[model samples]
Target: MSGFFKNAFLIAKKDLYSELRTRQVLGTMIIFSGLVILVFSFAFDPAQNTTKAVIPGVIWVIIVFSGILGLNRSFISEQRNDTMQALLISPMDPSSIYFGKLLANFTMILIVELVSVPFLFLLFDFHSIGSVGYFLLVLFLGSFGFISIGTFLAALAANSKSSEMLLPLLLFPVTSPILIGAVQATKIILSNIEKLPDAVAWMQLIGAYDVIFFVLCLILVEYVMEV
Candidate 1:
């Protein structure tokens, strides 16, 4: 167990270091997220009556799309540099690679969210959340599930000729439950119309999704990489 985590951390550190040197994945995600937020801000009128109604959907949609950009690149570097096979043949548990990649992807997307969220609040005229704690929990659960599944699909599609295109087609459908849960949970947090229990219900849904899929991905990634 210790070896599993140590190997995973090393793989994650390697990815993070590579990203820091090249700025490929993180840069694209941040820029894409910023532009999308700016465009939405301009397109939607903050003073409009429907602003709050649409804000949740817009925020989650932007997150999903921007995250796709990073997820698409998650395995591309390994393929591009011909290191996928080496990683696969390594003595470390294959789950380590998956968890490592998941960590890297999660970190990149989290950073993108942290940067763009304040801009989203400022532009959407969002003032406060009903429960800051619940809001963070929703964000964490939603992002972890999304990236876990995405990292799995990315490895599955890494060998494809049109992986860039194939990844989204494979990913979007599988991630619908996450999107639905996240958007609804976020809506509840932002609106605060419903009680804390209401948000808790959605949080439970997202948490279950995260745990189930994260475990499934960990168990199955070895077979995925083998083929």
Candidate 2:
């Protein structure tokens, strides 16, 4: 168990260092997020009273799109430098590679969400920071579900000719439940709707999705690596 975690952290550290040095993933995500925000600003009237009602949907939409950008590139860094094959050839178990990739992707998505959330609040006038902790929890759980499926799909599509286009097509449909759960949870929390039961139910659904996908990814990663 210790060995697995050690290997997983090692691979995760390598990914982190590589990303820190290159900034490819972070840079692209930030730019993509900015563009999404800019588009929203133009498409909707920020001066109107209806803005708050629309903010939740817009925030989740931005998150989902930016998340896809992050996930699509999660394995590209390894594949680009030929490090993926090195990891495969290493003594680490295949699950370690999956965990490492999942952790790295999670970290990336978290960073993007952290930056994007405040920007979102500032731009959209949606101040739910009092519940920031809960918002983050939901984000992390939702992101875990996305990243779990994404890590597996990333490996599957890594060698494809049009991986960038193929990944979202394969991923978005399968992960719609995550989007729904996250958006509903965010709405309940942000609107202070006092409907804890509804939010709790969605959160529980998110948890179930995360657990199911994580285990499925762990089981299927070996097969993905083999191919």
Candidate 3:
């Protein structure tokens, strides 16, 4: 158990060091998310309170799209440099590799969300944002759903001829339940602080999805890598 965690942490640490030095994924994610917010702001010309209503949708859009960019390269970089095969044959458990990539992608998405959420509110003219703690919790749960399966699919799709296109196609259907739960939960949170109980079902759904898919993906990664 210790060895497994150590290897996973080392892999995650390597990806983190690379990101700090290169900033490729982070840069693209910010630019893409910003453009999305900018386009939506002009397209709608929303009123003051309207931003609150649309904040949930806009936030998820940025998350899923920017997450795609991150997931796309999650495995491609290793494949491109011929490092994936090397890593695969190393002494580390294959689950460690998946967990490492999952951790790295989760970290990147968190950074983007931390920066973009404020910009999202700013662009949408949405003040009076309610319950910062709950908002972050929702974000964390939603991210777990996206990132867990995303890391799994990324490994499978990155080897394909149409890997980039194939990735989103493979992802969206599986992710729909989580997205719906997340969007609705966030909407309830932002609109009415007292009505949070209404979203308990959705939060439970997100939590279940995260737990199920996380274990499923972790179990299947070894086979996926073998293929």
Candidate 4:
């Protein structure tokens, strides 16, 4: 079992190193997210409470779209260099490849969120976390759901002519429940410390989504490889 996760980490490290060297996915996502946030910020003056009210949704939009754009890298690199075939033909477990891809996507999204979120929260004047630990739990559960489904769909769409287009159509509707739950959880977490019950319920929903999709992808990826 340790060997399984070690392989996943090794693969994740390889992608992370390549990402650091090339600045391919991360650079584009940061620039795009920054621009979108800036545009959205301009649309609302500080005097209006509307921006504050919409902070959770705004953060969700920023992360989701940026992630969708970046998720292409999950399989494109492998598809491009014929590495998918080599990866499959090698002795590595398929679940390792899925988890490795999931790790990279998760790490990438977390970095982007951490970098962008301070400014995001400051911009909206939100600092209402009941517990930092619980807030991070929400973040991880939410991101897990997003990346798990995304990595699977990205693999399925990697070879298509209109893969970029296909991914959004395939991804958004199926994942909307997690998105809504995450936004609600964030809004609750950021608004009042007393709303622990609401936040926990949403977290449960997000966790269930993560677990279901995660196991489904682990089983289905072998067929995705065939596709």
lDDT scores for all predictions? 0.87, 0.81, 0.90, 0.84
Error of 2 at 103 (Å): 0.8
lDDT for residue 23 in candidate 3, whole number 0-100: 90
Q: Give one digit per residue, the lDDT tens place, for model 3 in 42-73.
A: 87766855556877999999999999999998
**lDDT value, residue 168 of candidate 1:** 90
lDDT (10s digit) by residue, model 1, range 84-129: 8898878989999999999999998899889988888888888867
- For model 1, what is the alpha-carbon lDDT of residue 204? 93
Candidate with the greatest lDDT versus the true structure: 3
How many backbone clashes can be found in candidate 3?
A: 0
How many clashes in each candidate?
A: 0, 0, 0, 0
Where does the lowest 10-residue lDDT sum fall in candidate 4? Answer: 121-130
TM-score of each: 0.96, 0.93, 0.96, 0.94
